[model samples]
Target: MNLLSKIDIRQLQVLKALLEKRNLSKVADQLGISQQAVSEQLKKLRHNFDDRLFIRTSNGVVPTPFAQSLQTKVTRALASIEDLLIAEEFDPKTISTTFTICSTDLEQTVILPKFLTLLRKHAPKVKLAVKTLSLDDIDSSLLTGKVDLVITNPMFAPNNYPSTTLYQEQYLCVASKDNQDIAVQSSISDVAKIPQLVVSPSRGEFSGAANKWFADQGHPRNVVLSVPTFTAAKACIAHSDLCGFIPARLLPDPTLKIISLDKQVPGFDVIAVWHQRSSQDKLHTYIRELLMQAASE
Candidate 1:
């Protein structure tokens, strides 16, 4: 039999424990094995290495000169083996990989500024890739690793994917402060009659969340313009007489004023979604945490 084949990992562990403790009883206690078992492993290690390894004294066993010479090499070998058995811990500072996120303009305006600040502060080396949220391509994008995360309203999230609600958002009926047609306090029927700007990011159709509310009240909205993003809608609404409903978080704008309605539009949840495969991913977990923090702030 080969000398290398005769040496087992258990025998090496025993050898290391014995070298550190210099006492069979102490090594057994530390290793959770019996003293006799410790001695048996030591005996096998001695035979395999062809060295007495330790000499018994009145106090305890002490390593021989030959064993002392093997100490550094054995420690290094054990460390390498441990590296093989243990998982490497995730470190944000050391990460240099890019993370891609698909987000609507609402999230880009309201959530990502603070998120980017936190991400840059902690993980300066990590690169971020932002893609415009497209309902048509989101499923395949997440499944194929083209997108790592999707931040959007819960209504727009891909079905069956795992998601965490970052925050709840309510809609605010906003119009240009210069617009004289709308008032600070107006009934839903009143606003429904005014020419509205509908933000249809996924589709160019003049439809929106407030449409259902208006229809439920027997007064369908008069949507005159359709824009692809909230940013675009905001810009258009500020200059034109097209009043629109935007998320409350995008308020306090100098050019826009909120239109208080008799009935409020239903609020929606903003969520972070990822592929099922990334349920246990450390980087995804960290990013989600950062997203929640950003939303809270």
Candidate 2:
């Protein structure tokens, strides 16, 4: 197979639009190019792919099998490239744009509130579009331009995607006011043996690195019930005899104990990851940088 050159990206995009829109005039209108130009691009694309790419039908142009197979990947690759170009030319003050991001509920609940408030005060014109996606979905989404950023704690994709560490993923052992001695636990085993409350994202993603730590430490632990947020987890521990972890930044509650795991279990670092391709877009670049700054401080 021959390598796809940069010039081919535009041709593939035309094929993509043709495959989707079916009508030459409609495709041209959507692309803001003349119908003749669309036809010329399509002609070039058909020659390059050597596949009909699209076939005329009563309804409109229909993608051939080969074109159908190649459409998504080609579109995503082109989109990734587009993101890189746009990000390279970004200007935060003058340009107004929206960015889509995928993150854990914990990050959404805690960090996003702060980030939104900050952006509102400083960058009112900027907009954010947040969605929930499992860790498993991030890379494919990035490939397809589904989400601009993926935020995680203690780790990133195994693919070695570019990432910026925001802060330490903190964990503090906590108990109810009646059982404040939770912090005095000496070992992971000791902490584990304590009645524990579990908090997991909608995708079963744990808020932090505790699950991984448990697996690595060669320990099997017990979990009572899984809740949604740190606040909820805190509520469970406060009302019951259970103990669990919270972010270190959240100070100990008077009714609920908080103990930093600085000694027993290491804090996981926060990370914001994006495809290197994301750096090409002015919007992606500005938002990624702004989020990076938000994550760092």
Candidate 3:
């Protein structure tokens, strides 16, 4: 048992590399050591394992049948250990991880304003990085470790990612308080003729309720402008008579009127998404809980 305890990790790594790359020089390069060192380690490994781990072939070293038999199990066991050691274990107030979040103009409008204030008050040390989900490659972005958190309307989930609804989203139109036409708001269709300000999160988002409303009704309203984000649309609507569709919560100004759409567009579900690596993380849970409570308010 004492002799078995003396067996080293370096010997295992060298043996695995020699079995994989086959050439002495290639394994030496992988281990960042000399070819002679690999030979020495290989000799030690053979004596300890009491097996001919590799056979010298005409071209390069080939693993013996016994070595091949142990390879798969050994590799998996080592990988499991590696994952356990490298996993993220977080503490919110003490954490200094810079978390990147992907959100739309709409999410930035509805969620971020309040969320940021909450963050500053509670977790000042935690850093937040914002990225617009500007492309359809959201899954790839998360999988490749590009983004940590995603806040999108109705957090629609894809395979390899889990989702939870952060909030319920309702849509309404915002027009300037002084705009005369807004005072006569009878129905959604009544304002169809108004110059519309629409937001497509991705440069050309044609799928939202605002974009589809006019065409579906066979009455194409005058679209004064098309912007990529709701924040931009909100700014445009603020200073002009152009009507913009926005979430119900964001219109905090008392001067602005809040009326739900008569036409039922699907309600948006705000969600937070991260890779499986972060799913069990404590800090992720803490931030998520805070956002969830904020949404409820």
Candidate No. with top TM-score = 1
- TM-score of each candidate? 0.73, 0.60, 0.62
Q: Give the winner by lDDT: 1 or 3.
A: 1
Which stretches of candidate 1 lie above 4 Å from their native place? Answer: 1-85
Global lDDT scores for all candidate models: 0.89, 0.72, 0.74
TM-score of 2: 0.60
- CA shift of 204, model 1, Å: 0.9
**Against the hidden true structure, what lDDT does model 1 obtain?**
0.89
**Tens digit of lDDT per residue, candidate 1, span 124-168?**
898999999997777899999999999887777777999999999
Cα lDDT for residue 58, model 3?
Answer: 83
- Cα-lDDT of candidate 3: 0.74
Q: Which RMSD values do the candidates have, in order? A: 5.7, 14.0, 12.1
**Residue-wise lDDT of candidate 3 within 1-297, one digit each (tens)?**
564585676777887787689999998888899999999998988887789889998888999998988788667766776788896655566677687889886677667777878887778888888898755767878889788778764434465687778878777777866676665344556667777777766756434455565667765667767788766767777778787677766666555554445565455767887788888778777788777777676
lDDT value, residue 153 of candidate 3: 48
